[model samples]
Target: QSNIIKAEFAEIGERYNDKRRSEIIPISGDLSIEDIIADEEMVVTITHNGYIKRLPTSTWKTQRRGGRGMKGAHTKDDDFIEHLFIASTHDKMLFFTDRGKCYWMKVHEIPPGLRTSQGRAIVNLIGCEAGEKVKAFVSVKEFNETDYIVMATRKGVIKRTALSMYSRPRKGGIYAIEIREDDELIQAKVSHGDQDIILATYRGKSIRFNENDVRSTGRKTMGVRGIRLGTKDDYVIGMLIVKREGSVMVVTNKGYGKRSDLSAYRTQKRGGKGVITIKTTDKVGNLVGIMEAIDDDDLMLITDRGIMIRQAVEKIRTIGRNTQGVRLAKLDDKTYITSATRVLKDEEENEEEEAAETEEE
Candidate 1:
């Protein structure tokens, strides 16, 4: 009655005052795509053949060190696990391909799967070309203009571009780096434009160079050589953007791994043969992967036979870069470590869960 005008009181008779047919409800505001999707922790896994999927983080239970890990995926004879990382469903995922192109999508856009499901082909999701292979997957919360995208190729080429340059991506992907014939992009990292970039080779050689050493280039240009390969067979295996505090963790094919101090790798000129990272011999084998890891991080090691073991980084021995690392995973002769990644400590996840519960309340 208060909302009605005095002049309209006569028009509002018994029929007008009848019971309302609909209820008036209120909403906070318009909802966005992200607002509808649940922001939960997800485990993202990519196979060597470019099959990708995301499963709930609780799919795998924590196991003690040296416990036989469960089979992570069912792959064909030639295909195997290539990459694994944990991220939130709301996070942005950057997919860098060996063909020097980059694609962007939200983590929730990836096909969801169960523990034993073979994932959808990455090519089908990102519209990759017939022969293009996704070589690296980076999860970022936000694309800050001040940050930079650092990319490395198997032939030791490295490029740095402003992160804002890649803020807008196309469905078919855009050129990230110009690769010469026979050279392919190995991996990419998002840096703050002043951190150190480490390029690790399969032959146990690594070169640490500041991100500033390579001049920032446009998206479609070829980068300068960041390291010199000893031979054609000794290509770059992994790249790491490191800070001053954490150690450079390197894992070998034979399940041997170690964490070397960041101080051991002095910043060197780009294009020089790097210092010895690990002693690659008949026993320890060649390097499989390397990462910037801290004591609180959990290391996820995957073998070529689809076996995955999550070991605490602190359990791995910290030694000089020139010596062979201690045994991180016991492997049979037929199985070898293919790739490794880090899972942050549970404190962060616990905090996120609590925050979500609060929001729900």
Candidate 2:
């Protein structure tokens, strides 16, 4: 054995003297020479107690294998235990020790337990990538209050839900319930008291006008007195005249008992009492009275301020004939005019003219 060792050592030295040209060789032995010589890259091995020992030219490898008598078992400085246990990502690793206490470690923390199948699994799972899918089947030796299984992604954050912990498969994706945009409801209000009364030419037969239906342009007051309906007063009373061609007619009360007749005109009477015709144009007497000398359409309300509020011609009071009233008419220029007089029944003539015009058109 001594001669064999000497011869082997000589051969090893000759083969490895030139570091660049040296070849690695494995050998088994338990022999001591003053200084064992071999190729720098050579590896020597010895077998004993079912364990294999390897010797290399590097001191780092020797230390890693637990230098000298520390063979087979890792030394206190050996990091294999820690490297085998620590997670590689931003997650925690959990291990159940034989003592029943749970152990936890962060990705870079040193591991404390002997490497086992369960320990390996825990380490791998903790270092998984973000959004990585995982399925786990684990058994606990004993219940530990502090031992909580945190289901986290490789990112180390667990999704918060109403139930158990989970992680989304992908980041920045739409949620189960998407957020909605803001919406609102709008409404508009119109005050009848503020709207101005414009002469509107409507085609219809005998529409009735009521005080309630007629909106007041003038400020609301207890009663109609010295009031005007339309433009400023510039005409005489009892004379049904259209101030302007298209403008509404203005009827002024000249004196007492001088009533304007709008019988030829159409009119609508809304709310109020009495069938008084051409009554005195007293400032306080009657602002709106039923016509007695003309048809209902031929009546209008003569304001104390001399502006005539023309009743629409399409509206006719249901009251009898010979009633004094006014009827509203739309001229070719779309002007509203009120004609006051005794009741006139000329529907047939008007219809004939309408038909002729239609035929011509």
Candidate 3:
């Protein structure tokens, strides 16, 4: 009788169900990967063979400019570190290819590795086509209206576009500039609106012009001429933005380099024959790279045979614009310098007497 009575009571309770005692509150959203990751300053390097990796800034010990840098990466005999920079993990890196396309990614997304490790291939990170190769890249924390993206081609063409225009990114990459049949994009730099620009050629000529001379254009337009190449074989090797204070350092394929004041290179019109930057004798070889550097900066030299040396900028002699520079790297006859870049000093680090000759993999 009791069981029957309990069953009847349960059925009556089910029929008279009340509202849920606990409240079901909706949450704002889920946590994203960027939100959980901490932003850090990293030493990022990309090799000519499309390998890239990021290591902590502490991986490099500050050495007096002119010492062989520690082995930055375990590169193959045919490959070398073409690009090394310090960037925050949260910054966005915009990569421009030789085929005139632009790809985008965050710096933190790069794989982290040890100092001597060969990095992951860049093809696995970005959407690059079969024949396309990355020529230049710039890191930006925020795109501002007052800034511009300046680009230069191997055939001496230059283009400027508003930085805000590239705020949006596409999957396969969009055209940053229209490349011609025989020309390829060589350099891309971020510039303030009012600074001067320098274009250096392989035959030891450089032209300096104000940024205002080049009119801003759409993403797909071909740029105007920045310099007049003397011969079909002569092409632009590098482009640098000039400031009021820093000196422009020019390096040759035979390991010669020198620093000349910004005042020595008089400002010229956009499309004129440039002044001689260095005397190109058989001793110095052709011009290989140019960079804007200061006394406190570090200079990185990379050769075609995958050797790299890092030295202080102050050690290089400041010479006249028309003279041949002194030997910057002791290179063999079969090897020649291929690229040069400047690294700003990190204030928090302590300087060591010398860097290790090699790093363990």
lDDT per residue as tens, model 2, 19-122: 56667887677653313432233221211111112223242243322123222223222111111111222332233221111233333232222212112234
| Model 3: lDDT to the true structure | 0.87
The regions of model 3 sitting more than 4 angstroms off are 1-43, 47-49, 55-89, 114-116, 343-361
Per-candidate TM-scores read: 0.71, 0.13, 0.77
- Residue-level lDDT of model 1, residues 137-203, one tens digit each, is 7788777878988999988899999888887889889999999999899888888978888999999
Alpha carbon lDDT of each predicted model: 0.85, 0.26, 0.87
Question: What C-alpha RMSD separates each model from the true structure?
Answer: 9.1, 44.2, 7.4
- Write model 3 residue lDDT over 135-182, tens digit each, in one string: 888889888999999999999999999988898999998899999998
- Residue-pair clashes per prediction, in order, are 0, 43, 4
Ranking by lDDT: 3, 1, 2
Best candidate, lDDT: 3
* Winner of 1 and 3 under TM-score: 3
Winner on lDDT (1 vs 2): 1
For model 2, what is the error of residue 183's alpha carbon versus the real structure, in angstroms, after optimal superposition? 69
Better of 2 and 3 by lDDT: 3
Consecutive 10-residue window with the lowest summed lDDT within model 2: 183-192
